[model samples]
Target: MKLLKLVPDHTNIDFVRLRGWAFGLTLLLSVLAVGVTFARGLNLGVDFVGGLMIEERFASPPDLTRVREVVDAQGLGEAQLQTFGDPRVLTIRLPTQDGADEGATNAAVKKVSAALTQAFPGATFTRYSTVSGKVSNELIRNGVLAVVLAILGIGLFAIFRFEWQFGVSTIVAIVHDLLMTLGFFALTQFDFDLNIVAAVLTIIGYSINDKIVIDDRIRENMRRYRKMDMREIINLSVNETLPRTVMTSVTILLALFALLFLGGHVLRGFTAAMILGIVVGTYSSIYVSSSLLISLGLRAEPGEKKPARVDLSNAERIAPRER
Candidate 1:
């Protein structure tokens, strides 16, 4: 009758010692992700680049070329027809001119819709979404601001609750997780839509929460084990919290996996992002957050430091001893 041990209470893995390799690899991949982002850029979805999105369900798998034929006949301009999860569903995307007015774009979309209806009488549109060029630009700006402000907000909260080093380390690890997620998207050319932006923000929040959990444990250990080496203290705290981390991450991953498989293509990107965020977030909480302590000169004790006092009263009261 032995209980299962996810992480033994006395676990003594030298997590701090492996920081260099972990940090280096994460940094390398993050840098590469940025490089790729700048080079090829994200596969901008309609929300960011301005286009028409139509999700249609058919009696059966409609002919892709026939669908394209209808869109081209209507002169929708650069229409792409892709199959959604099952062959019974289709997603048609049409990119508009750079400065086309919204009404004009909508007219073109309507024409395509009409043509599609006539071409495949059995096809039915389940969703119709539109984004203007101006709106898309604004969305891009706002999305970036949201992510930055979220990080800044978390950093400020960490600073008020913990040391400045903890705040900085938390932000760094969060940025690492963000970069890794973005890198995965960039490399895979996944559709970077408003939904995905939401996912990234969610990831940031999730990642920071994980880091805070570990940081809380570290802060407690800093006071509890004041005489131990800082590295050892970090190792001890992480090991102590390892079980919680594993349990939380595994639970989150289970839900995300369920969504990834059962939620269909509509939620694929967002679910995949959550999946990636959890793993990187957990790693950063353990390695990146603790490693920064050494780099930022926060390895000292966490207790309050007393200011030096001159005791000027000793000179005035000089008769008691050899003074």
Candidate 2:
């Protein structure tokens, strides 16, 4: 039986030739992502912002405006209500209580539950959580630090393992992926919580893994084809690795898509981020990272003085002197 092949054998494509266009599009998207993030801001969850979050479900979809009014009538604090998953399900958040004491928090929850039940019969409280200002601040700081450290570490690894060019290109690609994810969250107002933080770190890992494979192949090709042009070497290397890259990406995407649709709303944001990362990572590995090597002045054989070729057939063989 013939095996399935996503990319055919002996495939040759000029991936390096389109680096200019890829770089342009990447820059435009990164800029737009940054601008959108600063302008619209991310919808942070209680993990980052100190608050009391309560999940409640009604027998039927209730008007959010009316529900907000009912919660506000209790005068607990400012209530923010958003649909969680189903229309009938909603997550209500309120500002941290004055003292943030357990009694006050529980009392507040009871009051809101009573008010909601009276306002909308059959409305049931699912769960509630609280985060203090200090803890939330710490969480935000740690999340940022984790992502930054991961990027720096991965860049350094690339530099040591391959070349400085690889490191720089890897960093650039990762930053692009991160900004794009943030922009998506900012635009969609998805809950940017700790789970999303984990996803971002995971993306960095996957991007680096993909990049390292192609970088290794490129380095190997550079050594084997010392006299070859840099662009030709890059194209050859990427084409050679295209099958593995495509196969790996496709399989991972299959799992992520399953999680996205069947894993419920809790994993929606995380799954979405992973899917985008896979696509963007694969793209950068092909177009941005590999091609950028040539532009970074990486020659087929850097700093290597071409050795003189000796004619062995015409030269007399020297015999060993008798000991």
The top-ranked prediction according to TM-score is 2
How do the residues 23-112 of candidate 2 rate in per-residue lDDT, one tens digit apiece?
Answer: 999999999999999999999999999999988889999999899889999887889887755788888999998789999899999999
State each model's CA lDDT, in order: 0.79, 0.86
| Candidate 1 weakest ten by summed lDDT | 314-323
Per-residue error (Å), model 2, residue 219: 0.7
Candidate 2 residues lying further than 4 Å off, grouped into runs, are 303-323
Q: Can you give the TM-score per candidate against the true fold?
A: 0.83, 0.90
lDDT of 2: 0.86
Error of 1 at 282 (Å): 0.7
Cα TM-score of candidate 1: 0.83
lDDT accuracy of residue 138 in candidate 1: 99
Clashing pairs in 2: none
